[model samples]
Target chain A: MGRIYLGVDGGGTGCRAAFWDTEGRRLGTGLAGPANLTTDFDAGIANVRAAIAAAARDAGLSDDDARGAVCHAGLAGVQSPQTAARAAAALPCTRARVDEDRGIVIAGALGPQGDGTVLAIGTGSFAGRRQDGAVRSVGGWGLRLGDCASGAWLGRAALSATLEAADGMRDPSPLTDALLARMGGTPQGLVAFAATAQPADLGALAPEVMRAAADGDATARGIVAEGAAWMERALAALGHAADDPLCLTGGLGPLYRAALDRDGRRFVPPLGTPLDGALILARAYAEG
Target chain B: MGRIYLGVDGGGTGCRAAFWDTEGRRLGTGLAGPANLTTDFDAGIANVRAAIAAAARDAGLSDDDARGAVCHAGLAGVQSPQTAARAAAALPCTRARVDEDRGIVIAGALGPQGDGTVLAIGTGSFAGRRQDGAVRSVGGWGLRLGDCASGAWLGRAALSATLEAADGMRDPSPLTDALLARMGGTPQGLVAFAATAQPADLGALAPEVMRAAADGDATARGIVAEGAAWMERALAALGHAADDPLCLTGGLGPLYRAALDRDGRRFVPPLGTPLDGALILARAYAEG
Candidate 1:
């Protein structure tokens, strides 16, 4: 049988897998629950396998065919060399490689030979640049320490502003009212919600803030503006040059596109998704 | 036996109980684990009982004597009327009253009849003012939404700054180096630490930041200045008058006292501890 390659992108919220033939023709894709290896290594491995199996099935491949495929997995929380090595060795595939998820974004947004910056704004945020096959990153310190322009950060900012309005530290506005209503109509309710919320749970509220901003709520608009400003700062810190190709990727990326000042910067469409980048690596490994 | 009164000061970190007789003579004091009602109602009730039992034992009181004692509990996370009612009903006293922890701070810092503001800066931070038997407050929304000048806030700010320095977003300073060393000398180690850290756990790092600030670390100094500014804002929002008696209370209170601009504000020492305030209330209930 011809060689089949599997690409996996695993993150805090979920995992995705894509299958492609040796000629780079897409076969199918599948998704599963959170696969952050540091949080649950066994669960991450399980989900990665589940996604790959589903993708293979979707592509009309038998179980044996799926097991024979070479895989490349780009995973979050693979920071340490030990974790990367362990993850690679534990994969279900006969031949596989593990890399940091950030690398996939760089390869996806800017191709392997491409050089520039990718501002990934999602449930979490990260900024990265690639030059001469080397990648450097800033931010993505998780939702607590950083992730400045991320959906999680935006939601957290909105919640703080809403509570501030409730406390009269800031003026009450439509945004605060909407947020309070959504959170059961009281500042105390918001407190209860925040007490147990995970980063993604908090990030789920980003849409509410975005909606309010779209409707011209001052507080919401201010939050979006602040987030955009932070993004600009992150881009600058990542050494993004004016003429260098820049791609904004991830769920919140499109929302922030208009807010960001793109003057003198070459805003380019991403060459491919992280999954596609993972497939590129898988293909290379299978050929080798 | 003379009437015995118990004052309980319960919070997120720990619980304190002070026993006194009707004549205002202190008998003994005891401490127990965290007793934030909403977070862990059963644990809070148990801790409160344990603290009172310990105090009673220390004062050479029998179980019956402890059961007959009037108790006043000032507890954190007693937000809603239902929680207050439930907490009051669950206490191990013949007669009892439940009040927000913030109220106890006001009474402790400014006496029952005194009218002014109290800036309680501990693992958390709160600002409250009492006037004509009514109390108004600003901030103290917990580590997530508010608590701007709190130890948790300070620690979190320091951590973020440390990460920023590590990422080259900010200049490396002694403060960042110290923080990294404490967390295992790596950014990834800090990330792991933060992933599992509770609010009190983060608050424990505040002293490190304070120490660095005292040693002239620019990042640490900036964090302290920012925290102090937040305190000033919180006090003002609590309707603090120019000449109002302003008292800083809590573990970190004295440390922040020197940093806060007390211009035109009447700075005063707290008349007693929260347990003292609780005892006063218990005494009133027992006598009445």
Candidate 2:
């Protein structure tokens, strides 16, 4: 009954919270709406608050006790240390820390001090390696400039090919035809959709490309192959060694891992969810 | 002294006006500020009027005469026929016509009825063919959707490569080095610049790539070669024939033409400027 730990896992889609007693026992977990700080800092904070409250209630802790809990968060859109500090300051706990959601994901996948790489590719993509307690990352600059091999990237590539095909520049394929039909059967309609689409909206089309590629659609297959090649190159750039533990995390991570060749790398399962990663960081902070 | 023709060529950078008499004599010409109707309709109209007024003054015509002058316009951002009609209705002339700037460029290059293709590449890009007085076009969908082979496209590609190189996903070269230094000396700097930069702002970097390519920079050479290849495909998609007259127009047009192979292609000089094409259309309308 000395103290409690609250771990927050925040992302573009939603916020989740878990409670753990100081004795290393999991108490309860809660979920709430999106908490992507970069795109919606206010909403992110609000959701994080709601998720924490729910977790505290589920753990049967008093409101005051919940407020006194030690907390650490791995959050999306923590583009700078200042933003992470701002997030920590905005939280309810007396001692709260925040880091990038990707970092937490990597930590959770490979453990606090595990040496390996995490290829996290959901709505966004980033390849991160934790080596000898050192962490480094690649990509994840967002859709305008980077984020290659991400869901948004795949969807955008399909849409681009569809437009080029519609313009008669490329051969029309089943994938392009189906995509154009879904996008209002006109290039202008697709263009209108893309003109104001957020990252999630574009990433939303990933399933269609994936499904089509699985079914052997030529265009979709090409896009996915190109993405796989990009992933290999990015991973290589991060100095991914042949014997390193490769844990593919995030919504699209497993899919990519399956598609990638396995001869040179050692594939491993994630030890825990991102929340567990956040919880591990929380425990580390308390110990320090 | 029967009827005077006013040809207005409006684009993102500025507007120009030219006058011609029934006797086929060149009257005068005028220039004004930016007049891209798509992005700034009111400003476009104002600039068009200013340009027309100056041309009328140069042709020794009064305000009433200028208002009475028959006008035809080839303007940037006229995306649809409805937009074209709206532009004509907003003009001072009782009889006015408006069309996509690329159309008039093609008309000007091929003399309205001359069968040929025009590869117009500037801040924007489009491939158009005039066949037996009928016209068809491809790939003018704008920066987000299309606009391949354009100045903006080239700049964006170079920046993308620079970011990849910075991340160590690809090898760095002199071209990427110089470009990264110019773009605030970092990937984040380039990203921030691109986040809000307009098409012209991005296109402003095209000359750098062109100059670098000329100086044997591998990255710059690759970008230009890619652009040239896109042009060839788009032109071919528009049914460019082996013996068809190919006239390159716009700021980046001739640069691409030079890079492309001349085999199976007939290169020709443009008959006149876009203003001349607008004037030709105006004359045809008055005669009918």
Task: Summing lDDT over every window of 10 consecutive residues in candidate 1 chain B, give the lowest-scoring window.
Answer: B257-266
Interface RMSD of 2: 1.4
Q: Would you list the C-alpha lDDT of every candidate in the order shown?
A: 0.84, 0.85
| Candidate 1 residue runs with Cα over 4 Å from true position | A1-4, A60-70, A92-94, A283-288, B1-4, B60-70, B283-288
Give the residue spans of candidate 2 off by over 4 A. A30-34, A40-50, A62-68, A262-269, B40-43, B46-50, B62-64, B182-186, B262-266
Error of 1 at B16 (Å): 2.7
Q: Write the per-residue lDDT of candidate 2 for residues B79-165, one digit (tens) a residue.
A: 678888998998878888888787778778788576889888889988889898788998888888689879999888888889988
Question: Candidate 1 docking category?
Answer: medium
Model 2 clashing residue pairs (backbone): none
Per-residue lDDT tens digits for candidate 1, residues A132-244, read 66789888879888888788888888999888888877777888987888888888888888878888887888887888888888998999998888777777777778898
Instruction: Give the per-residue Cα lDDT of candidate 1 at B52.
Output: 82
Please provide, for model 1 over B1-288, each residue's C-alpha lDDT reduced to its tens digit, 9 standing for 90 to 100.
877888999988789998888788989888899898888889988998888888888888887887788988999888888888888888777788887788777777887576878888888888888887678988888887888878989989988888877887788898898888888887888888887888888899998888888888899899999998877777667777789888888888878766875567668899988878887677666666
Candidate whose DockQ is highest: 1
TM agreement with the true structure for every prediction: 0.92, 0.90
